[model samples]
Target: MVDASQFEKLTTVAKADGVQQLVVGAVVQHEGKVLLLQRPDDDFMGGIFELPSGKVDPGESLDDALRREVKEESFLDISAIREYIGSFDYESGSGKKSRQFNFSVDVRAAEPIELTEHDAYLWAPLHDDLPVTDAVKDVLQKYRELRAVRRD
Candidate 1:
């Protein structure tokens, strides 16, 4: 559980800098496949494949925000939000300059997730062929690196 005081401190810092966007995503893996979500043609990064994620609410801890976003977007209860994979900056098609924090998470389960903020979802094989945005790719590269080390 996150501390209430820490949340307040984070909220203060976010407000101080006028940070408008801080998003989090899960690099959810099961059976060697990673989860991917697609934005609708009308939305930012439309037609691009990416991990399930969303904006962090004020006073929200990063891990808590990650679990909430994954649950809301993918309908999966996150069992754990693991190591910090990395972060990347990007400008969505809508011109929203945002930063995305990525992590490897374990999911309790997943179904055909309801698409409210996304157009589609898939459990993609973590291979070179999987279509994904550069931001997601950066996160995946880290996942791949960690995976290799574990195999050693």
Candidate 2:
């Protein structure tokens, strides 16, 4: 379940912390691997891999932003927002201080992952050296710890 209060607390805290922009990322896991998307060399933060994420439009809920972003970037509908994987602050292309709230999510399907915004996609194994930014790497680490605890 999607909890509006939980999402509200996230935004509330971020605002208190003076975060200028809000973004949401999804960790879509399948077959022991998590999804990663490669940016186009010509785009912002190009030639780097990242989570399927996007900016949260004004007045939009964080959970809704996550679902919309995952769908927009990968054409994969989110089935569930499983867990909150914490967040990291960064400077976006527009030089705004942005904080991304990441979550573990389940998609409706695993096939025909049509890419709309990225040049390529990879199903990276959890233990490998992921070529993502430090922020994403940290989120994945927390995700790994959570998965381990759930299995025990």
Candidate 3:
């Protein structure tokens, strides 16, 4: 479980770093695979694979935003946010300077996926070279590294 006790610290760090928008991303894995979503062809960053992610609502804590975004985008409820892998900076669809905080999470179930914001979803195996943006791929790489260490 993630504690909102880190909320002030995260926001302060973001503010200090001049991040205009804060987004939360989840690396949701079940079995030996992590979940990936394909963006709509007409949407921003279209036709690319990405982790379930979204902007954090004002006043929403990081954990809350991550879980909500995963649920809303992938229809999967996060049971636990296991680790905070790291973050990456990028420009948003509206050109806002954005930073996405990434985490490794576990869903209650990996089935019954209903993608509302994307066209497709997949349970990408960790052993494969994933087809995602450089930033997302880095996050997933870090997640895999962390998970491997934990399991050791």
Q: TM-score: which candidate is best? A: 2
lDDT, candidate 2, 1-152, per-residue tens: 55889999999999999999999999999999999999999999999999999999999999989999999999999999988999999898999999999999999897679999999999999999899988899899999999999999
Residue 70 in candidate 3, Cα distance off native in Å? 0.7
Q: How close is candidate 1 to the true structure, as a TM-score?
A: 0.82
lDDT of 2: 0.94
| Model 3 Cα lDDT, one tens digit per residue, 26-117 | 98888899899999999998999999999999888888889899999988888888778889999999999999998888888889999899
- Root-mean-square deviation of Cα positions for candidate 2 versus the true structure, in angstroms: 0.9
Ranking by lDDT: 2, 3, 1
Q: Which tens-of-lDDT digit does each residue in 44-86 have in candidate 1?
A: 5588888988889876777789889988887888887666677
Please state the error at residue 61 of candidate 3 in Å.
1.3
Q: Which ten residues in a row have the lowest lDDT in candidate 2?
A: 1-10
- Measured with C-alpha atoms, the lDDT of residue 109 in candidate 2 is 92
Q: How many backbone clashes does candidate 1 have?
A: 0
